[model samples]
Target: MVNEISNPAAVVDEETFSVRRTIRIAASVDKVWRAVAEPEHVSRWFGLVALDGAGVGATGTMTFPDYGVIPLRVEAFDEPNLISYRWGNDDAADARPDVLDPEKSTVFTFTLEPVDGGTQLTVVESGFERTSAPLENLESHRTGWNEELDKLVALVEGEA
Candidate 1:
């Protein structure tokens, strides 16, 4: 059964300009990993996600209903433990690989660890200061992570 969390809060780091959130999921590490790493599973909770490849060095796009399509490239993939991506800083209407700029991208990581009964999931998104509006972007992502992760938890727990 899924143990539901009351409130999942995301912490924002001003010095590093990063957002971090942690939550315990009532699922196995591999289950949580598939939800976050796999494109098909990700689209169910996060957004309309499409990835070119599965392993590291893969490129993809996640199109949010409100935020539109954000170009992303897989930076790290460590099986069911960790998966990370660097996404474009600007929110464009369409996926634009031609104008993809790494310098203006932000890195977000999903890490899963086996806990006593389930898995401990941690998400960290950094490099917000590189965006056009640092503070605005930080605040936006801070809220975004909390809401998005809540959906993740709900989906994983079969509550959604």
Candidate 2:
């Protein structure tokens, strides 16, 4: 049988620094990547609390209503294959700090590959160091990825 989903978080020093989720869709890898890398398509499922949208090298801010706004920047792009970006430090506390960890801000990547039965989509987000960033930082992202991946899977399979 083919695998439909896989989310193996890469752990470092007992804490998950990054959360990676992958889903095997019935559609082509290109189709899956488009839904992930495009702005309007990502807005359907990813908008934080409010949607600012996404595009290659485009920087935007997402409003979170009660959570304030988080700025995001696209750092890499390879059509239908890879996309990386920098976002606010996931470890930032609800209360703002005088200084944010620049290194821990983040760089997320989405890698798409065609598997034997379907498309294998892998998302790897790494930037947090074991000691500097709070463990909660990585945990928050772990939860967010779970929700986002579900939305992505639904969006792609549901569409014609």
Candidate 3:
């Protein structure tokens, strides 16, 4: 039997300055929602998330052990279906501001849909053109979404 999760690698669109990836997880939308929207669950698969508050307009940081803390904000949320976060994506910067810089931030939105047996999750990270190195950051985030979302699939599916 072939053992694989139906997840396509992330793609970087130069024209749009964005990275997009979609994956199917053997877990319900509710389960997947928690994994992506909750900071604790997100930290398990992605960066170490620390939000000052909850829901839209909340501001905080996601601390990656290797990459350090980056300013982040909850840009949008819609129950268990959608959640969008804007975070600093300036890969070439030597220092990061304590607050999210709208001009230099990229927003990554997670949209969840119910499927026959699980959930279809798609994440699109955009606004890379405003970052320091658009091309490099686009590719970096493209690779990042693949790795991070795969970890998320494992975490959510394992629990289900």
Alpha-carbon lDDT, every model:
0.84, 0.65, 0.88
State how far residue 10 of model 1 sits from its true place (Å).
0.3
Winner on lDDT between 2 and 3 is 3
lDDT of 2 at 66: 49
The lDDT leader among the candidates is: 3
* Cα lDDT over the full model 1: 0.84
TM-score of decoy 2 = 0.73
Candidate 2: 10-residue stretch with minimal lDDT: 92-101
Over 76-98, each residue of candidate 2 has an lDDT whose tens digit, in order, gives 88877888876675544442322
lDDT per residue for candidate 3 within 49-154, as digits (tens), equals: 9998889998888998888889999999998999999998586545475867888889999999999878899999999999888899898888888888888887
Error of 1 at 69 (Å): 1.3
Q: Assess the local accuracy of residue 142 in candidate 3 as a C-alpha lDDT between 0 and 100.
A: 89
Candidate 3 error regions (>4 Å) = 1-3
Select the stronger candidate by TM-score from 1 and 3.
3
lDDT-based ranking: 3, 1, 2
